[model samples]
Target: MSATGPAGRVQPARPGDPSHIGPYRIAGRLGAGGMGTVHAGVASDGMRVAVKVIHPEQAQEAEFRARFRREVELSSRVTGPHLVPLLAADPDAPTPWLATAYVPGPTLNQHVLAHGPLTEGNLYAFAAATAQALAAVHAAGVVHRDVKPQNVLLTPAGPRMLDFGIAHAADGTSVTRTGVMTGTPGWISPEQYRRGTAGPAGDLFAWGALVAYAATGRLPFGSGAPDVVAFRVMSGEADLDGVPAALRRTLEKALAQEPGDRPSAAEAAQECVTLLASQATQVVGADAVPATAVDMVTALWDVPAGEDPAWHLPPDRSPSRKRLIGAVVLAAGVIGGLAGGVAALLPGSTGGGTHTSSSTASVPPSSSTGSARPLASTAKDDKDGTAANRQASNGGSATAESWALTRTAQGAGEHDVARAVLHDEGVVAQELGDGVGFSPKSVRFQESRREVYLSYTLASDEEGAMYAETEIARNMCLTVRDVVLRLHPDLPYRTYVMVKEESGRDPQVTWQDDFVANSRCRSAADDDSAQDSGTDQDSGADQGWQPDEDGLGQAMIPSTDGAEIRVADGAARKIIAGTNGIRRTLGTDRVLGNAEIKVGFDPGNSVMYVWSDYLEWNQEQVESWADLAAGEACRALVRERESAGSAWPYSRYAVAEIGGSGYLMIRSGTATTRAACPA
Candidate 1:
């Protein structure tokens, strides 16, 4: 991490800028915000960091200084694996500053503008990564309060959420004055706009909007003057013209007007991961670079003396989530920065729903298949095909081209067909319109029997939504019929609308069988299906060899006489048993899954792969057990080895599959390499 960083490449530090802050030698500048300038600085150790220094004028104010110190204290609390971990800080210094881990990449806004929207694979990875980051943030009990595209940074591993100056726990004190509206204008939630307190729910709304921008190159609510955009957001009038089909349902709930209607960050992440599995959104090539991190910027939305509050570096498209704190400056990320563009290649779009958020129905289990194509966009399906035709004739801007409907072959299996419909929000929203607005709750697309079904609570389920429920169902039926007939005109287009018992999970889960299960899908796309979403981790990913007919795989074996057998499991096991070479241990037996990686633990901890059957437990039962014991396993490993060596802190984490055995292994670190346990 150098004093002068990549961000400094854009603009050099001004003549008046300080040459050093603490041990960091100032090089150039990242950017300036209302609070202070963020410069690229290098420590004597040659570590590069983004240094935020407060302005002298503000530093003189005790109240402002207090806020800055508070922000630094709170910011230090957020130390997620991918977060911009705080490197150094000196709030009491004559010129106060804070340094953060510097990531090398463009912001999401810049990446999109330069690359013209992400591919379906990149988008899923992007969503998954952001969701993971948010999960960590929310788990820490801190509300980011602001999350938008500009704040997202695109890197090789995935997206990381940046900035925490203003982030605070819901149970903690509020950073901004009460009644002050703080946040980006267009991306803020209705509750926040009305000055209501928001939690993770509000951030979810911004996440949906950010995804929309990534896919359509436009905000869900078309960009407009502040008042207009705010009105549209409050009114649930989203402009989801070109978003892809698969993602609409999830995004709809995420963007629901009610803060309570959005899925938890973890749930949203699972949806993205699963949807990607269905869509086969895997890395496309050797050169493929996965995106990482969110953007940050600063802006002020004013309220009168009796009134409100307000809130990048990326682009107006600028860096999205502005840093919450900086020296005399109460906040960081003063704008006017570099960043990009509009390209549509996504799953869905919507205005919102009145439904309350609910947990997903039990996911049967993990699964995969690639025979899928994105469900066609519904913007073209509006009004009995008239608009679709017009748009196509006019070059498909509002229809197919922007959405980029992947061509489908005949008889794409029931599995593939179910995926297209269940995943695509544009198709669902357009087909099921105003009277029948329905946000997706849970959808299961079974390949067998060509069945695609998921439960749904009405979009609102409030008085307005209930009153229109009947009509919504009627319209939903009509649209489903038309959509079915259009896609599988020759095959049996069977769609049944049923009402099922309420699960009582949400008050809004009003109707039984509130879902419409339809199958017009005839076949999976050919070329896409051929690409493997993942190879067996044992053979391909981990660079391990598959066992031969007799179970002799690639390994190295040496006997006492110095005799050796090449590619022998004996040799491999012996080699792994030693500490100097392979970092992790190889399972001695083939009973468990050949490849098992541990997750959620610090490195340098020992672990052993165990079979569920050996313990008389089923895979499901053991999986749950492993999750609960992952941390303990590392601690135990450290404890058991304490007499032998010093127990350093555990740091390694990964999710590994226990061999073919029913149980999956979840451990922290290798026993031989990761222990510093005391005797």
Candidate 2:
């Protein structure tokens, strides 16, 4: 809930903090750092802006003023939709101050930690937007040396990148600290550590790490002491476990040790946009704002504003200024809110944090202080309701779940969103149970994973296994259709169909996949309409159960050893050709060394296993890789059969495996459209 913006209440101004700096009236404290303090201020025209004012002692130093002037210049030169626009600055003032347009939302780090990692459209959108932001930064000939989660604010519109404090011009006209490192430990580029100065490639490297953090809610380089984390960054060993495969490939290229090996900012942005296109239902142009991402980010704003806290100023640290600046600036671009005075508070106005909070602050000591503190929970119920209402107006589809919710602390009406989700979940459970001919033991929606889990008891027999697989596929498509039509179309969710032989036994997940209703299933009304119009081939029904190429349903069943597996050379050729087409369209160049396509017919199993090197990528990446392959295969199969005047014989579920060792089932059904879970 914490973000650098004008909507939330702020801490009361400290005694030493200026009430009026330039033409802006300081209302309250936004943050503080080594550079100065950031204040929530109002202009003469009543427009709210984050005002960053240098400390009186720092203003006395000529070198400090020159650096402040350089920051103002750099901020002015950079312009983009994803950047916090600088409004004004005056370096010659007794206390140098700068102001920037305030945006209301939580930082990426805060949102990920409070909620969880981003998924689906939100993740894709974030990657595209942040990459575009960097494109702009680079285009302006500015190298934003500090590009991390704390610097990216998630707003209802999209993400806005902050903190240009240490940003140096590509032409080297800026006054950067020559002796100190200018970026966060885990996010810094290897070349920066080796050469002492970072360029646009360094920002792109940070972008790779930042996107990975947003998708997984963990640092790409695992967190530890600054020196240790820096060592990992320099070693070029990033843990991209939870990242999607196709996207992970892009990150891998971006994280390459050599600067020339990394893709340009524009190229990276286009790549992200391409990935977003692969998961979109409708035609999304490169410039289109990702609506689902906007909605997901908007939901994070539905929290009550906190009461302003009392501000207390720390004692001066003039004696240790040099050492403090050297150490703290290298670790976190800015320092403020420290017990010691070495760190000063700055507001979002300046865009770098040294203090725990600031006008434009850097990342905090831990993960908490780099931006605004998380929203407090003490406001009136009506106020929280108002925030929720605003969220609705902003097109929030999913309700924001508090980091930790308690019945009493949140009050009676606070659980409305949770209750609503529960009600919808029950509805889905009932529908799925009715369709599959039995009640599920449990149905739970995990917001963090963006998945719905439904478990049912089935007889331990061949008939039961077949029935479970068939019904689960058919019903999962139907549920996806229902969710898209009656629930949230903007939010993508995976449906996990789990089965168990006995009530006391642990459930075995039969299939789980993100099925786009538009391409995989049709409403009952639409099905009837398609039949009546003699356009069944074009309807979603075409994606349902179908016979084998030999006009046999059960005869195509394969053995456990895959000995009876059959492959149509023509179908295989079509699939491979389609995969290449996709690769070309998306500009994906990463090819696994031992990439192999093993196609076979197995009616009894009805699962297509895609095995890959586990050491190179994790389970999620493997699944993502399989999903892409299967989607291409699905389209190719449909086309090949259609050309032969027949229906697609294969209804195989795609599953991912690690080097053919472990089975990691992925999709319940095939992907019939580009979107992962299109409406």
Candidate 3:
């Protein structure tokens, strides 16, 4: 074990001790740890700084020296308002030390010890700020292996995180040895304790434990020997004696035993901020003025409501106010891993990939056509393929069937093919991969468009991996699907419609012959390959049509004018009729006018539509138009109209065998026009 101060008493500094170390003037000894001693100091300009120097004993260890060198390099690159800014360092010196902007405040542990338990509101605020700090740290691709209350300082500004002694850059040369835990016992995640593989999630687990302590003045695993505490943490049990009910769910999730089970610092920060905001609103009431809220509110005002505060900070402060300012600074610094060169490691650290082993599947370039043949199989295929193939061959005579699987890739990758296949069967496929592999289960086919999503995992039984996996998978699936549909024009898709007033109301349908006539006219102008008038005459005459009761339906009206008719109301619904005569609704109000609709077909009469809603805002109309007009214009862009035929009211707008759905934008008069999917 490392030596402590004589009799465990903090060593006192002598006046004649070298006043200057490198560029800093040593003022006083601040504290001492197992590996190093910290001294209060200042630059030539009298700028306060904290200098941490390696102990002579530890300096003899080559590994420790290298780690200290890495610490200097990492500290220099990390910058944030909440973190103690690393001003200088000299790793090559006989006595290595790092000088950082001095932050003055009581350690969080000291504060809790002196002041008792923190109020629920303050605890929530602290958690949020600390989570944000950790986010910054994680973003930098570094993990503060030691995330204890003692490492956190509560300054006047908020919180400033300190002590990166145990922090390791994701790509740094140093590798943790097995069975060597770098974190405090009680706050370490199960993975950290057992595997010595501390990552961003492990830091999040520590943050959760620290928050639990701050809120209730007690560790979640009860105050006991490190071994017992480690046992409890590894067993996935927590002692939430005084934790608030509102925060229990979040804390429980974050405290899950597995590293994969814990909520991300980003997510935790969001929840903490939300919880804090709710508590603040309750305390100040709805009628309270914004200006009088806590100083934290001032930082939150200019950014997103729950945005991490690591991105912004107040100006510099004087020494007298350092303690208060330092608290906030420390709070900000807690996001240690989110900035600098460390950020590059975040993507791979989450551990996600999707590839059928031993099977070569090539992603076709540009062209849509491709040939798929079964190749070499692996253990997974051997266990499931025979049954799957048997079922596929015997289950139905139809040419297409629905299938679903959990997405295991971080972003767009091979996992999408599975989703596409499931969609072809009219099944709503949900994604399951969130950079982190938390949720391990996925349900491919539910009841029609409404599918059951399952996230049960045997691995999660040991911790919160199940919950984390599920949330990440669902969120990743949604994000990837949405992004792909938005950016790729040729992908078959649909539009989203959000109704604030009518959550459960089934959509109403309206059809107009005038709208159909206008669609035909516009199609003639837009489609260069459209059949000439002679072809139109023959096809129009052959398909004798009649209008519906509402002067809509199979109408054969021909027009020469290139005018497109559209619906003005956003609440309108559009449906494209497929070969099976099933009408698939394309756009909801939210997705209307902003995205285009693409439809795909299967041999079994099943149709799939890919919705891409990438609408650019018309700044002029947005600024000048009335709310209703602006809303309509936005919707129009999403639900733009296109015609299939050249004849005015002929087969142009015919709702026959619609294989897919799409939108076309057009400038028609002063008002923007929108077309509803054919009902």
Candidate 4:
């Protein structure tokens, strides 16, 4: 969701630039560095991400790819408010790429060059925040070899430390290449130059130099040729002129010739925080930021008035639910930065989901093979035959390359398939024709049955969406059958079409069925197996379920056998444990079936939700699957609530297994057991 900034901030992508990378759609170029070009990209769920793709020449080297992979692993582990988090990565791809949550702001160097050196509260906050970022990096056993001014981005929230590209674990492994300088001139530590080794201490040296430079708008060590800077660093020469009295002493200690003499990142952060509180404003706690500091930092940027609203950093005064979810994601460490591509590699993550501004859905890897190969094989079964032939039929090597890229991304479930459709927006639109358009943001894919959910937002209200629902479904089916299905024809493709009102209410499912090119998109009467169209009709005709006054539906639970009840007892015990209870294996009963139900909690909202890839679009199929899952989950909750006399503090819970199907059968109830719980 990288915002299109003013001219110099984000440049248009060149003709040579990639239109898409993995599951992200590249929007514009952010910048280029030694490693590779960084592009502003958007995820399928409209999350803005900063994607860093390695240089082709560098990617050719086996050593570089190994380091890049290590960088991704290490970066994902280091998370903090002042540090950019790694989102997704595929170092094994032809040109290895990694994506991070996009932070829109000028680099520390850029800010200083345009607005001069920071003063008072702004300078103090920057130092403390950057130190906190370093502490987080070091806590993860990573040493950021390059912690220069240009790598720190300034935002209203505080400073964000970027580019752990050269960071390596503190286990003493060498990440440096022969004949390559690991750090920028005038910033590299004396130890790095003299002994050719850098540890966490070197990062401290750079942090001090960075803060000093920010205070005085000059390099701590005299700016000169590389040799001269190295000499200055080795000679322990540093200038702290014009620096504040209290901060100058700390900077002097940080620039000590001996690595051990410098304060630890934690100590430095506390010292800066203390200095800011004493001079500028009162700090509530050691960790709490002062309001004056944030105000000063915000004033320093001077962002243009008409810039994209998406570019605004979250307000410093209040924490919204969106920010709370972000905090949860960073704290949970389960879905830390590595959302799409590398989820399988994370310690206990079954797979990751695409997180949008509001909601998220996790899809486990192909349960059939427990690997990505099956997904690639699905695409290989394209109408044109083998991947090579599919490429030729599509008219280029780019298609083959993109397909291969899709394979790397397939580890994250439907992300690969979703990217394929989004990348071909033009072709999909051409097939849909006038008045009807393909909504890129509305496209959500499910890999299990090759189901793609799409929506059309009407210019009018919900009534308007209902009025044209039939026509919209017909157009959507035609686009999918004629264009999307032809590309990957192997799977029994099922599609769901949703109609959304312009007023922003939740979209309602209008169509849920498979289609073939044999006849024009028709009603269920024409296609016997297809479910009837219209949201209201599907609910009443098939399930005979009605919504309560709150519009919350109830999950229908079937009679559970004694064996299923016993299994539910064990699951109840685990759920009450409050750790990673949902993901742990709940021993299956024959009645429960094989499909695993994975649960997630949003502590911010006090809601627990379940997700499963086994659910389908058909009403009957959904009911069948929902019964088993709902009964088991409900029994577990009932046991915990009744036996322990504790409701576990969750106010509401839901079943959203068929996410992106648009027709989410959300059954909301209290954490306490309900009538649906098996007796």
Whole-model lDDT per candidate: 0.41, 0.47, 0.39, 0.48
Pick the winner on lDDT between candidates 3 and 4. 4
The estimated TM-scores of all candidates read: 0.40, 0.43, 0.41, 0.43
Q: Clashes per prediction?
A: 100, 45, 68, 3
lDDT of 2: 0.47
Q: Candidate 1's C-alpha lDDT?
A: 0.41
Compared with the true structure, what per-residue lDDT tens digits does model 3 show for residues 1-679? 1111111122235332345666555655544322344565555565555556654433444555687677656655555555554566666667665555553355566567667767755766677777877877777766777677656666646666765433442112111111112445566678865665777888788777888888887766654223334555766667677888878788888888666767788888777777777766776675662443234433332211111111111233323322111111122243332221111111111011111011121111111111111111111343323433343234231011222321222222222322322221111111222222121122222223222222221222312322332223322233223323323323332211110011232211100011111222111122222223232232221122211111111011101111211221111122111211221221223333211222111101111111222233343322221223223333433343333222212112211111123222221111122432211
| Leading candidate by lDDT | 4
Q: In model 4, which runs have C-alpha deviations exceeding 4 angstroms?
A: 1-8, 165-178, 280-679
lDDT tens per residue, model 2, 139-172: 8777777787767777666677776543331111
- TM-score: model 3 vs. ground truth: 0.41
Error of 3 at 173 (Å): 18
Deviation in angstroms for 72 in model 3? Answer: 1.9
Query: Candidate 4, 573: how far from true, in Å?
Result: 73
